[model samples]
Target: MKQIILYAIFVIFFTWNPAFGFLSGPIAGRTGAPDDICGTKSCNDPPVCHGSYNINSGPASFFITAPSSYVLGETIDVTVSFSNTGSGLHGFQLTALDASNKRVGIFQSKDNTVQTEAYLNEYAAHTTVGTARTSWTVQWTAPLANVTYPVIFYAAGNQADGEGTPEDDYIYNTAAVIIQPTSTPTPAVTDGECDAETIQLSQNLLELQKGESREIVITVKEENDCVAGGVSIKATIKKGKKRISLFPESGTTDEIGQIAFTITAKKKTGKATVVFNADGIKSKLKVTITSK
Candidate 1:
């Protein structure tokens, strides 16, 4: 009779222990699934661990970090972190989806603590429940084709106390949105008219007090002095990126072959240089900021 009791206790202990049991299968897309539990069935299935434990109602303890914008076909780093440092073991599932709720990016990671889900290549989850970690980073490659909608990264993290049961454990879910780069309009070509040869700035030097702003105009022209409209132009701060701000950093020339930029001086009193590129043609502007 004692042997039977011990066997039953052992079975119950392992059954509720997340480290040794539970979540035996892949856990992709389960972050936003209808059911809060992990690994009982597909993301579309109903809740199976209803009486096990109640979902935590406190502030989110998990967060995702990703770039605000993504270029087509580019690979960017996305990281998931847990705020609860006291947890002994951690597990997570993450996936990126488009506005339509369809998976949109591929995830890759070198960390042994995490792996891509076997059922869905897009979902990345913890490799094992036994590994104790606070954060995981994965490289996500944006789709090659243009996805007009924003890409949202969903992540769910489990903070376990490693106490051999689901009691006191918490699950947190969060998401981040990444926008697509603005599209540049194509230029209309007329016999040598679109050949950009020079970039002219309205002001080569700007002097401003702290917290002041000034506007400058850029013009693109061809060898024959013809205005080159629809020319893609990019503005970069060569120095003192933190001391000054440039607005409309990148844009296309209007029909008059002109584009405008607004430069604002920050609290710092320093000099900065802004470089402008218009279809290979380059120009530089100097800016000096003084204390008010």
Candidate 2:
């Protein structure tokens, strides 16, 4: 009995990893070719291995590079690159979270504030991937107003076979988006109150697509919430899946509650949830379109 207990303890000790436990999985997706150990062999001839059982995956690595420091009210640009180099398909997802792992901010729901990265299998040539193994870039710019906090990047994908590998989820790497000391100070506004009353109702979400036209409209509202001036006021928009900036500038609201601006192909393709911010207030709306 003592020998049985000791053997079980040794086996458990050898299998634990500190960072993530069950996140890894069995091989996933259909197999193009079996491992050398099981090449063209029947079950009786050789045994097969399984892992991350959703899709084939490889080593996934990414890095975030931004301006050395951030400044309040100044737009700071962030760039990230992802690389897949394993035998199977390896991929990941992205979002911004504070050091404590809480997602904070109004990205993409309003102004199309930032854009996300897609795998080559999802899009055409935006970021090429194949046997050579390369990195793809996704760019986003946000107005740096919050005090320095850690931002996290999440990357997730499928695992092909059931060999207990990282083909299904984030397998190889992950990190926090870095922010340097702010050149300007942040105002106290963490109470969860976003001063939303200041937002104009007509101006809502912005739509984004990879290679199509997007129309965004903004306006300055009077005390009664009517358009005081057609001059374009500012706002931000985001899509729910992942925040991607559609346009850099505000859209022009015409006499009516219609503000129209077009998003170009340089911006990739995906569904986006938009939010409009104005006069210290914020509001939300949705726009989703497919590219030509």
Candidate 3:
């Protein structure tokens, strides 16, 4: 009699409604690994964990878009998106790994559903509130450049039935993107009879933690990485420098037509503008200082 009761309890456990159970709906990281990153491995067809509803032949689609090549140390944007065959429940995991499988750069979510994880991985799923839309989007800042080979991005998606069964849901779809390093630039024609080209900082957004120092790179490129030769550049803090300092405010570009400077901030400054003056043309980089 005791054995019969124990068996009955076990049956109830598996039959419990998933909508109210531990995993209720698309918990971002709970999906087991090896399968979570479905790029190289196969996810179980009838997903042993998540339930299945309809056996759909069409696979969910994952997409990544980024520049074919990027300048060294340049911060650029990368985008990822996913969609499936009209499923109310969806979840996704995406990450970028270098040649050695090391996570690179920082990821910031553009939507509430998306969240970044350690090791350059990011996830998005239908919250408990859920959504009728079948697609999600996210943005990633490329790692501080100079990555010679290529950075590969891998993503996986699930088209769940929302019924909480592993039998009818479609669990696996994968995509990848490769970004290569920008090649050396060949000097292009002068800009409309100018003796020398203008210069600007390679990055427009400089984010720093309070009481921290970072080196900023200034470059004069007429076209792409082709550095303009013999250009003079000067940097000045237009505002909020009382809490920050820049070294060698005035300098001439090297053979590559670039100047490197250091910025040290003593406290949080909501925003500071670093103005680059070259050939009478001025450009600015916004320095966003944070306390944390």
The superposed Cα distance between candidate 3 and the true structure at residue 101, in angstroms, equals 2.1
lDDT tens digits by residue: candidate 3, 1-292: 0000000000000112553342323334332222233322323343344333221133665455667556555555555455546766655555554433455555666656555543234443333332344555556666665442335454444555656455454544332434344544535535553334455443455555567565556656554345565677788899887767888888876654556677776675688888888877788767766553
Off by over 4 Å in 2: 1-61, 73-77, 82-90, 105-133, 143-148, 156-170, 185-292
Collision pairs in model 1: none
lDDT of every model, 2 decimals: 0.61, 0.32, 0.49
In order, how many clashes per candidate?
0, 73, 11
Residue lDDT tens for model 1, 5-66: 00000011112455446443233445642222332232221132222322323334667888
- Show model 3 residue runs off by greater than 4 Å: 1-47, 50-56, 72-77, 82-84, 117-131, 145-148, 183-292
Order the candidates by lDDT, highest first — what do you get?
Answer: 1, 3, 2
What's the distance in Å from true for residue 258, model 1? 25
Candidate with the larger lDDT of 1 and 2 = 1
Candidate 2 structure quality by residue, lDDT tens digits, 142-232: 4344421333333222222223432233222222334433553333332233222333322132333344333333333444433333344
Selected candidate, larger TM-score, 2 vs 3? 3
Q: Worst lDDT window (10 residues) for model 2?
A: 1-10
Question: Could you tell me the lDDT of residue 189 within candidate 2?
Answer: 32
